[model samples]
Target: MAAWLGWQIESNWADPFVFAIYSLVKPLAGALILVFMYAVIAKDGLHSPLFPGVFVGNALFIYVPAVLAGISWTIIDDREHYGMLKYVYTAPVNVFAYLIGRGVAKAIVATVAVVIMLLLGTLALGVPVRLAGINWLFVAATLVLGSAMLSLFGILLGGVTMITARHNYGVGEAVAGGLYLLCGVVFPLDTLPAWLAATGRVIPISYWLEAFRRALLGHGTEAFASLSDGVLLAVIAGSTAVLAVLAVLGFRLAERRARAKGLLDMQTMY
Candidate 1:
């Protein structure tokens, strides 16, 4: 699945040079946009103390679209494009496990995106990541827990896409945009309106971003300090557990309904 995904990402350009250039350009362009936005707002170019936090936030934000689009489109691709949904449904293999494998593949891609962002930010944007002070173990732990939560969230999104049979790309974009605003991807949650802040609280991405920034930046604000590593990990674990159950149930219900409605192989209008 991972190999297939890698091919899908780079298969458009037959030339290896062009493919490699685009593979770097796409994510690096995203990082540059965010960095430029920050510079414009701060009027400090790359010297803003907030640059590192914003860069890190924007870097990790790559996961939102990667996992969500990957899972949702994977479903859309198999069912609508390839017309293989029914065969997979009838097969002995677990469908959810297959989805997880695909999600892991996307996660790997997202990790590469992060590395690209870091390198671009440090070398080109002159954003200081302070690698010497970062706690590698804590970063690893936070990434594992956060990735689990995000992957489960992707599964939930996939299940919803299966149920609706709507444009999965639109659904994925909506969810990713909402998270970008409310999940503190490029700013602090406290700066948001009261209602927005409240909404951010329930989403695991908010906590994940906070914990991750703390680990990578080696400093914590009062807001982040309010929640210990133990508390953050607990919330992430609990959310993943709940999301897992919901995804399974949702996927099962969607499969049953599609079978009943004879929509498993239905052609997508869009």
Candidate 2:
């Protein structure tokens, strides 16, 4: 199936040393900068409404570590890990605006990061980026949608983290850390293990990747491998859209309940 889908990995490991560093350093550094930004914000004022901004903004490069780090910082504090959740929910602003702002910021950043990474991959890493089958339009569209979906997942997790007794932050971190790899950011999904691939089907990011590859990288992306394939790009995109809407509703409902019960006033303890 990998061969059929034209899944070939071109290695540049032995390439010019400086180029390799340049290729990897930017994203790593960018990711670190994000972590630092969040850390400073968290330290400066954990109670500020800044977390939603920090949480959504750093997602630009899909650095789950940075994202989770911000998440951890946003929730955990000196006295209590879940400090800011209470105050942020009390603010009078339209919560969706905050959510949308974060999403837009992250999407723009991720798109720019994608451009920078591609340039680094080609110029610095010595990676061959075939322009064949690259559909700039659809790729752009899907990427926007994909980033939005990922942001929604972040929000959903953040909200759920607040109410749940289980400190699944560790598990959530592990899962987020593997998002890019599991979703085939640097590798092809076709190369995923049988079970992993099966699970990948349910993740909207995977379908977006498969479709994005087909639209941009080239044809035979395995996204439209089978017309009858249950996990079609259309289906994944639609499902994620629904999830995004539902997440917004869930946030509203949570806020209302938190206000009514005064849970919003109590300090959250991990």
Candidate 3:
């Protein structure tokens, strides 16, 4: 799985340098868009206090969709593009474990993307990141815990796509996009409608992002102050545990259905 993921990244471009550049450029562009949007709205250039919030939000936001699409698309890639589903299905190795490996690879990629965004925001865009004031221990804890939760969520999405939209990779993309909006990536959850804000409360990303910002920025925002740090961590950890179990169950069900319907190797008009 590690070798396959390495090949996946390397095969994307002709040169290793180009691939590295592409990875940095893509996330940088995403971070810049939100930063500049905030600048425009505030009419105060990039020096607003809100810069850190937007910066951290966009930087971390890249992981949510990237992880989901990475794991879910690998399913489409193997089953549809490479026509290797039959081989994969018949393998003695556990399929859930295979999916977890793919998710880990994607999580590593997302970590690099986050680093690139942080560098770009601080070095290029002049977004203030007070490195000296950051609580490195808490930040590290938030990142590790948050990544695990997001990866498990990705595995769950992969299982759902396998059962419902095996041939359509766009389903993965669409689900990620929806989560981006509903997860409060760019804006505060309060900005959303009452129902949407309520919905965001249940999603782990909301708590994860809030805890992330508090750890990195050294201050908690009002949006997430109702929950203590312990509570936030508990939610993230508890949700991840629950999602891991669901992902395993979901994969089993999806596998059974695919086999029963003869859809494991079936190619459809996607």
Candidate 4:
């Protein structure tokens, strides 16, 4: 029911044709920006060996902003926009599950955007992707682990947002930008400064993307080429487990604090 509510909220904004076009056009425009940047920087343009990894990485990175901002925004939207958060809290629904369900809606849209970008890259931009060549199992595992980790992060952010007296939607966007640079979405981590690269190494999303890249292209950046598939998967799973505990604890504490302070129903007009 929560998922259904989320889907309705997301999809009911426009007619199917308009929504579909918005989905395609937004991702397409974003991809074109990267394509133009690659063209200018790489002498070989789209034909360069680095193009596929960069293209695929950019294509998949959309989920970061979608899931993170989507879930966190639910708290702000319900409280500030609709002024029903207090009611929502009193309702007999699991708030955590509702937030996750909202994030799931964003994930569903992100998946469609990803598919459109991949199809465009393969057919027109010459990304050299073949559906028959993909490792479906690995991709599935990576997607699940990565999405779960990201959703936890979103929940943590939402919990924090609940206590904030001021608007902080930019927090999610800031985190997404940080992840884009730190997770090697468009460039290899090794190319970063030594300290920065080390920081990237510890992030689960870095390993997740490396695993995902290998799944799609049968190879990934040399930065993680030394790690076997098992090791990569292990890192992702272990980090996600750790993050799950933290997100739960943090959110519960935030909930308690929000209740004690009577901030759940507070609204910042801005």
Candidate 5:
């Protein structure tokens, strides 16, 4: 029900056709920035061996901002925009489940954006992802495990937003931007300083992206090129398991604080 509500709210702004067009355009515009950057520096341009990984990486990264910020945005949207959060508390629905549902709704939308990006990247940009060469299992596992990890991260951020002020709308996006820099989205982590490379290695999304690239393009970036596909999947699953515990515990504490301080129903006019 929460997922249904979230979809309705997200799609109500435009009709289906227009919404689909908007979705396709938004990601492409972002990709063009990377395309132009590569064109300027690479002698091989879009045909370079490295271009496929870069193209697929940036294309697949739509989920990070969409899912990560989308769930956190729910807290701000319901409490500040609709002012219906207090009613949500009074209702019988479980808050954790509701947030998960909301995150799933965003993931569904992100999936559409991802498919569109991948298709366009293949046909228009020559990303070189042949269907016969792709690993469906890796793609499926990465999407499921990666989305779950991101949802937990989103819930953790939503918990923080539950207690913060209305002006804190940018919190989730800031975190997503930080991850973009640290997670080897468009470039290899090896390009960064040693300390930053170490930090990126610890992040689960780093492994997730590596696996995703290999699934689509038959290989990944040089950052984790030494590890086999199985090792990368293992790291993603293990890290997500650890994140699940922390997200749940942190959200509970944040909820307790919000309820005790009367922040759930409190609205700042900012």
Candidate 6:
């Protein structure tokens, strides 16, 4: 798809210094998704899957591989190419700390891209996005906690599958193309079949996206009226807490295993 879109990835463009990083939107979105997937799996386990978010995330992961991949590549290319992987791995900082910091940087970059895309849509393309400004507390809450959960999940995937996954490209592509169909990011959940919608709700992205849209699009007051503000707040807060703890635990475990086996020094491509 990136090739079809005429994206030419050059280490250096016609100009000498600047790198030609085109079609970055998709990858940035993928990073956010990587995080989202981690949260859903950890919190809901496999039973209550966050299909919608997973779908969207999986779809974005194609050429746009998650931001973590980009970060990993930077570390690999610039640092590891110089035989620095072993040095970094031996740092006093625990494995989870390193992973979380890297994940945070990647997720933030993705989010900035998301903001840029929104601005482009409104300013360049004349997309009319009305900011109802209702329940902004919830929207802000979603932006922070929701994104954190997503990032933590991404890190978890990094922890469990980051190693021994020779088919990162294939797996990422399958995820980006297939998962979004369920996420309701590009399409509404109601548009899907009843069974599918119900199933999609089991996924994480749908829950977060729907919750976000309602808060942002002015649909929350009507749809979520049944629940008290405290209840909704609790859900968001709980998701954050759960994801945070798991992210720490997951990264530590993965790092411990990887370091023990000397996998961190193993050759890995972005």
Model 3 C-alpha lDDT per residue in residues 88-155, reported as the tens digit of each score: 77878777667667666666667788987877777777766678977788788888887777767777
RMSD for all candidates, in order, please. Answer: 2.2, 15.4, 2.1, 1.2, 1.2, 10.5
- Per-residue lDDT of model 6, residues 65-114, tens digit only: 34434333323432335565566566675544554455454454455455
> Which of the two candidates, 1 or 6, achieves a greater TM-score against the reference?
1
Residue 78 displacement in candidate 5 (angstroms): 0.9
Candidate 2: RMSD over Cα atoms?
15.4
Candidate no. 3 TM-score: 0.91
Off by over 4 Å in 4: none
Please list the residue runs of candidate 3 whose C-alpha ends up more than 4 Å from where it truly belongs after superposition.
Answer: 3-13, 165-167
lDDT of each: 0.75, 0.50, 0.75, 0.88, 0.88, 0.50
Give me the runs in candidate 1 sitting further than 4 Å from their true place: 1-16, 220-222
Find the 10 residues in a row with the least total lDDT in model 5: 46-55
Cα lDDT tens digits, model 1, 1-270, are 644643564354467667556556777887778777777877777787767777888888888788766777667777778788778788887777777677776676577778888877777877666789777888888888777777777777877777676666588889999999988777777788989988988898877787777777776444467788779878877887887788778778877877788877777767
Q: On a 0 to 100 scale, what is the lDDT of residue 76 in model 6?
A: 40
Q: Can you give the lDDT of residue 129 in candidate 1?
A: 64
In candidate 6 the C-alpha lDDT for residue 85 amounts to: 50
Give all TM-scores, in the order shown: 0.90, 0.60, 0.91, 0.96, 0.96, 0.61
The deviation in Å at residue 90 for candidate 1 is: 2.3
Scored by Cα lDDT, where does model 6 land?
Answer: 0.50
Candidate 1 lands at a TM-score of: 0.90
lDDT of 4 by residue, 134-205 (tens): 999999999999999899989989988888866476777788889999998888788899999999998888
Model 2: runs farther than 4 Å from truth? 1-26, 29-87, 106-109, 130-133, 165-172, 190-192, 220-224, 227-233, 265-270
lDDT of 3 at 16: 66
